[model samples]
Target: MTDTPIFQPGDALASARRTLLTEAQAIETLAARLDDAFAEAVRLLLACRGRVVVSGLGKTGHIGRKIAATLASTGTPAFFLHAAEAVHGDLGMLTAQDVLIALSHSGASQELLTVLPAVRRLGAKVIAITGNPQSELAQLADIHLNGAVDQEACPLNLAPTASTTAALALGDALAVACLEARGFGPEDFARSHPGGALGRRLLTHVRDVMRQGGAVPRVPLSATLFQALEEMSAKGMGMTVIVDDANRPAGIFTDGDLRRLIERRGDLRGLLAAEGMSRNPRTIAAEALAVDAAAQMDEQRLSQMLVVGKQGELIGALHMHDLMAAKVV
Candidate 1:
């Protein structure tokens, strides 16, 4: 008989669904298997004084690199090393203070086994992540994280699928746990990711980018439209805040308001600031996050807002331009 199989509708779809279920079920099993060994690995990682050096071969190596990156970005210092390259002098990077994480799906990767002894000799403890907890790699490790899965998504069951997924999930769990224990917060994450939108939202506070001091446009409620217009022009923020006797904001007269007044009154040059201004304008705190300010402005369909102090006194002014300049928009 010929080896070629017959084609059919939905066959590929059926296979894909089966594969996903297999891999997802594998992770569930791994979660159930989590025991003291997992805790021990976490403790060792937390106690490590130096970096986490991850080493693996082949497909395991790809997973190892991703794990190392996640750990590093989340506050756990980590870097990836190839087991094949370690024997060639890369092992020198490991020291007693560091923790060596070895990933081997079969628990019998020769390249990894070849360098384990050398790393151990350097005083570094080993944490093995493998599918076979009873294998030689596991036996040699100071701690083992069981990454066992029943079978791979490959129809032939020869390729690494469920195993690699389990390994990656376990790695993420470890990184997040360490992150929480260390009190790593958004501000710290922003420091590491200074170019991302999330970084701008967290690191760029309202006060850092607000127009303050004399740069803020202000006019007494008793000021005429002509006087308010001059204040707005001088401040260059396109708006002027009208303050009450207590120095709290009572209203705002924007260039938009001036245009509307000209259209309706036909003689705004003689009107008082209070008669032409929008009353009880939206306001934000000077210490609030720039992200919150952006959200507030977007929600209100506003282009400019007044920044206030804790006691509701106007301290600064911000426009959509300011948020854009700060890269928070």
Candidate 2:
């Protein structure tokens, strides 16, 4: 267990609020400074045939790497290269088809200055993100993005706090603009992130994860309790859909229904499924997203649901465990 701190909660809370407000104001300032240059940078990136190459130094380099990643994941092909290494023959990565986004808060990093001319000569356009608009980098680049901040969130105003935030926000703005301009949709995002749970949520459908045909555990409405129990045990999904003569679901029988019937009558030897099953059980469509099915299960506090078609015919069954195995949850 952790011990209590020396400072009072009220004082600490006040300081935290001040820090957040400071960064908010800094972002507001950057937003106001955004101009036609921002749009021009967007246009340059959009027209580029090759990849986007991002470079920076130290903390600004960290921000650049993240910016590059965001851009790539959002359908803009991009990668990061260290500014210091660019001068040491790393410049071979550049070509006329590529675009370079150089990040330097001061716009005076020696390493970036050393390679800017070479990158330009190689025919790759440069977009400089710098706080000092008059600095060499901003002056030399084809387009200058004004990432200036009023002050750092630090009390000493020496660390790269608010400045980095402004740069990151601006980078995010550019990536989103590019994403929208290209009409990149969720399906495209899923393709980019296929290994994560988010990918399963966006890419998977109920039909893909549902148990269909003979795999679906179901019994007729007239099936006896013993018969329904046998089907549920055989399927091992802990529930069975009770269907009518036309193969449409009229009700459902689950382990919970068995427990309730046992408590109410203390015996179910001669009971039929229609006598004990819950009528009008909620259902989901087979065409729905698997994540939507998970949401419905959680919302209804159920472990399984009958999957049906638009015509109210039983097509399959979806279980909570299926969603778990598919990583939709």
Candidate 3:
């Protein structure tokens, strides 16, 4: 076994800083080197009717996988195909309408070079990302993106460090440019990521997390304060909706109103729900988003909101707790 040298804390930190600075500079240099070729590549990808197929080997393969994911999530149809695997039979995944993005630092990866003729014969256009502009892969490509970097961050300057960073940054720029050019909005993004937070906020409606029918606390306006309290206690919503004979919400009575009533009247035996209730309670449509409801509640300093229909009749109720339970808040 070889003896290892112990690194001091400062030595480790300094090394990390240098690595970051080197990678950052590599991306900066790549940005400065961008030309009409970058725009042409973007146009090629944007015009593709079929999927984008990214192919690479070694560390470049890992970056290719991430690039494919970013492209897919940002509205571009894309997937990764291992260059070595392509020769083994996976090349069948390629189609005439597809666009192939080939990655190689030296631009001479044997597996990629071997599959190039087959890809061309299949009629798919090629975009090569390489450090060597004069290499065979770059020369054969329909559009070549120069991803050259000054040096690697490796101590020996041999490991794939800064080169990979530059390549990944270039991939991200392509994905984002395609996304913007397509006019992809948040709603479009949310559709692609239904399990994410933004998806829940945009897709989940109030009816999905509201208390309906018997579960909602409600009472007639003619009911005594005692009856409203009974309904509130049974439903556990901290408040009760006071509706008229047609079942339209006339007012709302909460715990705060009860306390205020007791302080003012001193005797609540004959007080009716209508007299104690707060008039013109805030209402939200059952079809609205739960996040929008939460925003309305926050704006009004309310813990609960009445859900009404097109005819302004009470249909359901929503509490802040309901939104929390649904993970929409």
Write down the TM-score of every candidate: 0.83, 0.78, 0.97
Q: Tell how far residue 215 is off in model 2, in angstroms.
A: 4.3
Scored by lDDT, model 1 comes in at 0.91
Candidate 2 residues 169-213, lDDT tens each? Answer: 999999999999999999899989988767888989999899999
Pull out the clashing pairs in model 2: none
lDDT (C-alpha) at residue 35 in model 1: 96
lDDT of 2 at 231: 98
Clashing pairs in 1: none
lDDT of 3 by residue, 269-305 (tens): 9789788899999999988999999999988899999
RMSD of each: 3.7, 4.9, 1.3
Top-down lDDT ranking: 3, 2, 1
lDDT of each: 0.91, 0.93, 0.96
Compared with the true structure, model 1 gives a TM-score of 0.83
TM-score order of candidates, top first: 3, 1, 2
- Candidate 3 stretches with Cα past 4 Å from truth are none
The true-versus-predicted C-alpha distance at residue 284 of model 1, in Å, is 3.9
